[model samples]
Target chain A: MDEKFAAIGEAMPRLLDGLVVTIELTIFGAIAAFILAVILGLAAASPAKGFRIPARVVIEFFRGTSLVVQVFWLFFVLPLLGIDLHPMLVGVMALGLNYGAYSAEVVRGSIQAVPTGQWEATTALSLGPIQRMRRIIFPQAWALMIPSLSSLLVHLMKGTAIVGFITLADLTYQLEQVKRTAGTLFTYGVVGILSYFVFALVLMYFMNALEHQAKHKLGQGKSLWRILSPAPPASTPAGGAS
Target chain B: MIGISAAFEWHWSAAAEVLPTLLTQFVKVTLLVTVLGTVIASILGLVIAMAIRVLPRPLSEAVKWIANVIRMTPIIIQLLFASYAFLSLDLITIGVIVYGIHYATYMSEVYRAGIDSVPKGQWEATTALSMSTLRTWTAIIIPQALRATIPALGNYAISMFKDTPYLLVIGVVDMVNAARIYGGDTYRYTEAFTLVGIIFLLASYPTSLLIGRLEKRLAYKT
Candidate 1:
């Protein structure tokens, strides 16, 4: 028992390093994904096939393949093609592209969920497309997308673990090393899962807060405390394709 | 890392030669794993969602927590645990179980959503008609719920198909595994991995289109 505690104590610092890497990868990957999702998702919903087709193809290509393959392709294959990126860059790109494809659907769905009348009202006011989408449609849609986007973000964070296979030394890799040296597979496994759960909860808390603020701005205000509480059973969506 | 300059060259002949074997593995292993995984996930997910709905409050809450933990954690961890805990199990069996259970968590949520979409009036109507519990669920509720659930389940199936590559972590000879090995031998990582991506695209893209069609057909009907 003494030895187990000592080993855990010793492992904490190393595990923290891995946790930092994981968090960094997730944040960068998420930012990239959000950018790609917004651009491609809007293109997909656009009237012109020229824009829509390419966006659809890109989204479909990313969504169809396994993320592991995409990451491996980036990490291993890209060098052969003369693109020598750091493992972190590769991890972020692969994760961003893959999850971005899924998030595109969320973006499209939420944007469509904006009342049809709003689009008509914008048109009636003779607002340009960009101006109307910026001022009116996007704000409303962003609120509806929060729950889905939060779920996708959690999935992307979990995906950071897979980057370890490409030698990123993320939390999973760190935990695996700890498990090996400590001779405590079960203990480390429990700790690793709990860490991920805590990260997810933390993420969800912030996302809900964002949702609360967005809803409030849109005049559908709810208590901040209500938003901070975990999504009740009826409201929670699936963990998605992760 | 070996002879880095020469390794960068893409040899067309070798890629052509390796293509058949990769396709064979794609069909025999990758597709098989996905089909089996989807079957297990669908049945288990329904059972779980049903249990959560029907079971008493405390038990259901406990089940929800377990499901959430399973759903939220990285699947690689679960795969590793399965590899360790079920040491006697073969890779295919282990792969199917892990993949199924991992996705089953999502599927359960999909099921829950479908069940929730069923109107309260439907339930009250069943109760008024004095339908038995089994009949109420099996006949009315399940059928209606399943219509809403099919597209979601199909999406999960496509996701499972792509994720079969992770089975390689457990040493299962999945499509990605086959690609990596071929690449290792030739050091032509570019062709092998690119081909693997292309094959995945070929398989999943059409299926997604089909699912979109299914979703459209089922949308207003329900």
Candidate 2:
């Protein structure tokens, strides 16, 4: 027990470093994925076959293949094509493209889920396609997609573990190192999984708050402040004035 | 750049030589793990969902917490941990079991959602008829729940299939591992990884389309 505690103490800094990398990968990859999702999703939902077809093909190709293969291909094969990238870049790009494809479906679905009456209202108001999206359509769809997107974000964070395979010392890799030193799989395994679980809980809390705020803005739900505070049912019932 | 290009080129001959090896490994390891894992996950997940439903509240909450922790953790880490902890077991066996249990967490949620989708009326009707508990579950609830769950289960199976490569950490020599070995031997990563990607796309694309269709059909029935 003493030896194991000593080993854990030695492993702490390295594990912290790995956690930072994992967090960085998740954040950057999410930004890139969100951008691609919006673009490709809009294109997929477009009436124009030219835009929709290409977007569909891109999404399918990325979605159909395994992400590890994508990461390996980028890391191993791209250098031969005179496009050498940093390992971090490779990790972020692979994650971005792969999860981007999945999130694109979420985006398209949420957009489609928006009431046709809203679209009709925009059309009746002589709103252009861009205006219809920006002013009325996107805000509603944004709220609808948040729950799905939040889950995807958690999955993406879990997926960051694969970056360790590509020689990036992400949290999983660091934990493996600790496991080797400690010679106790159960201890480190518990620590590793607990860390990830805590991270996921934090991410989910943030996403839920974001979802509540988005819905509240649309006058559909209680404010985030209210949700966070202790409920006084008699004082302010649901949908009641603040 | 010029030097690297000279050193690395896609070889049809290399690909042809490795194709048989990859395919053999794909069948022996990758597909085997996926099939067995899916079976284990499906049955185990249903059991978990039912357990949570029938058990006392505190016990069910404990089960739910365990499931969430497993679901949130990375499969690669789980694979590594299992491999280390179970030194007596075959690496492939460990891989399948770990994958099954890990994914069973996600599948349990799907099962729960499916079971919840079965109407309260159905359960009340079963009670009214004085049907045995097993009869109520097996005859009515499970069948209706399964219809809603099948497509989602199919998606998770495909996901499990793709994740078989994570077993490489435990030296499972799955399709991706075979490709990696071939790449190391021939110093031709381009063909091996690209071929692996193509193989994955080929296998999973059709399955996803089929699932999409299945989902639509199931939705109509529900």
Candidate 3:
């Protein structure tokens, strides 16, 4: 136990460096995914086949295939055609496109989950497509999208470990180096998984806060903590009202 | 000539040479890993979901945390660790187990969602009938839960199919590994990698479409 603790202590600084890379990839990749998801997702939800077909093609191609292969393609194959991207750029692009495809479905589903009456009401208001989305439908859909997006954020955090495979010196790569030097898989593996778990917990907390705010904006109820707490009978009353 | 070859060249002949090896590995290794992984994952997930639902709160929460740790870590790292630690199993078996456990966390969530979707009335009906706990689950609840879960299970199977290439890191000699080896030998990286991508697309795209249709049908049924 003492030896294991000592090994972990020695490995901490290097692992922290890799953790920074992992966090950077998650943030940048998630931002890219979010932007692309909304665009592709809205394109998918469009009534026009011209808008929908290309979006479907892109989404399916990325989602259906393996992300590791895509990373390798970007890293190895692209340069053969004279497009030499930095390793970080390659990592971000691969993750963004891959997770973007999956999250696009989440975005499309949440948008579709909005009540039909809302769309009809918006249409009755003589709103254009952009106005209908921006002013009316999207705000409600944003709340609906939060929980699913939170899970995707967790998945994206895990997926950042793949960047280490492409030589990004991310946490997983650092852990592998520690394993090599320390010659103890158990010690390093536990530390590596715990650090990832911590990263995931941080992400979940942020997403939960976002969900809280989104729900508040949607007028679902009070803040998440208050809503989670049990209420007094006189204050809460019965569930008689919609 | 330099512009055309350097910019992009198909090398159909080289691709043709590599096809036999790629196809053999595709069926025997890639598909096998996916099938084994999905089977193990589905069973493990169902077991975990049941455990979480049945166990006492504190114990269940501990199980949940363990599952979350498994879920949040990358499969490549898990594969590497398993390859190192579980030396008794062959590399491919280790690959399958690691993939199964990694995705089992996702699958458990799906199962949990399905179980949660079971109507309260159904639970009350089972209780009212004084059904044994085992009987209540087996007869009343699990059938309904599994009906809702099958489509999602199929979706994850498709996902596991794509993720099989990560087995290469553990020296599983999966199709992607085979492709890399072929590419290295022939110096035809483009043909080898592109063919591998094409093969993955061919298998997964059609299956994904089928899964999409399955999801639609399931949704309509519900």
Scored by DockQ, the top model is: 2
The predicted structure with the larger TM-score, 1 or 2, is 2
lDDT for A123 (candidate 3)? 90
Number of the top candidate by TM-score? 2
TM-score ranking from best to worst? Answer: 2, 1, 3
* CA deviation > 4 Å runs, candidate 2: A229-242, B1-4
Model 3 achieves a DockQ score of 0.49
Worst 10 residues of 3 chain A by lDDT: A228-237
A1-242 in candidate 2: lDDT tens per residue?
67877887888899899999999999999999999999999999988999999999999999988988998889888887888999999999998999999999999999999999999999999999999999999999999999999988988998898887778998888887787667747545777888888999999999999999999999988889889888634555679766
lDDT of 3 by residue, B1-222 (tens): 124345247788988999899999999989988999999999999999999999999999999989988987777778888888888988888988888898898899999999999999999998899999999999978899998998889989988888888787677888888887886687677887888888889998888778778778877976
Candidate 1 lDDT over B1-222, as tens digits, reads: 445565667778878978998999888889887999999999999999999999999999999999999888888788888888888988788888988998999999999999999999999999999999999999999999999999999998998888788777677777788888998887888788888999999888999899999999999774
Shift in Å, residue A181, candidate 1: 3.5
Q: Candidate 2, residue B36: CA error in Å?
A: 0.4
Docking class of 1: medium
Which residues of candidate 1, in runs, are more than 4 Å off?
A: A223-242, B1-9
True contacts kept of each: 0.65, 0.71, 0.55
Name the TM-score of chain A in model 2. 0.92
